[model samples]
Target: MHAKPSYTEAQLIELLKLKNQRAYNYLYDNYSAAIYGVICKVVGDEDEAADVMQEAFIRIWRNIEQYNADKGRLFTWMLNVARNLAIDYIRSAQSRKSSKTESLTESTPLGAPGYTDAIKIDHVGLNAVLDKLTVEQKKIIDMAYFQGYTQEEIAEELDMPLGTVKTRARAALMKLKHLFV
Candidate 1:
């Protein structure tokens, strides 16, 4: 097989901005696995993850001109796109309805092999960082960041006041900051 093409980030961004198909192909070839991994973590279902992955790529291709190198790297932007799509997918009414069925199907019969997700938070030490927070703090951070819930949405979903949600989110962030430091 021919060696895959490689381009520096700058060169790839330039080519992508120029709408070069080869550059798009290279970006997908190199980054799809990482993007899919993020999507899988957010969606937790392989079929839905694959669907979200397609939507993410389409979004990236359509919005390539909107990407600003001054803000962040290409992969980071693409990851956010994929991750947001996955979160959105999970929050959709269709996903909620299907999840009811999926949950039932997901359970293994007795003696069946256990299934593990493709991505593990502990592998990247996110679990360790999260473990430092209280349950209430962790719930706020997980819903706000990982699950892509707005503070208002989280409040409504959890039946808590918006102020309480905001307070917990801020406290969670403060605790997380200490962990990084």
Candidate 2:
């Protein structure tokens, strides 16, 4: 087996900016798992997450020149891209339509051929993290992150000002950040 190529973040950035195919391949090999994790957290389904993952890499490749090292690290920018794509996927009209159809098809008649009871699986880590937040913060985080609601959508759905929603989300994330560090 061939050894994997390694590049320092700076080297990788330079190579990516040059549009080197090898650099792109190396970037994908090294970073796809972390990127996929972020996508999965937002997208929440294996199949859909896979689709968004491909789109995210394409976006990263095509938009590599737009990345500003002064703003943040490469991974952070990529995560934001993947996260935004996932949010867009969930918010899309097609996704909404599919979700509705999926729900209808997922339900089986009582005593039918392929009937199964609904499972209640607790996301312990998510719950623990959420428990640290206030009721207002929790509502915003739940809707924005787990339920895949955009901040604007959350504000509208909650009848809150968009600025207020943004403030709450920022504060909530800050608190969660403190918990880990």
> lDDT of each structure?
0.75, 0.72
**What does the lDDT come to for candidate 1?**
0.75
Q: Write the per-residue lDDT of candidate 2 for residues 64-135, one digit (tens) a residue.
A: 999999999998898888878876776583455765334322321112221122122324554576578787
The pairs that clash in candidate 2 are none
Which one is best on TM-score? 1
Q: Give the per-residue lDDT digits (tens) of candidate 1, residues 105-171.
A: 2421221122244346534475576467787776666566556768787787668999988888888
lDDT of 1 at 45: 67
Clash list (residue pairs), candidate 1: none
Candidate 2 lDDT: 0.72
Q: Best candidate, lDDT-wise? A: 1
Candidate 2: how large is its RMSD? 7.2
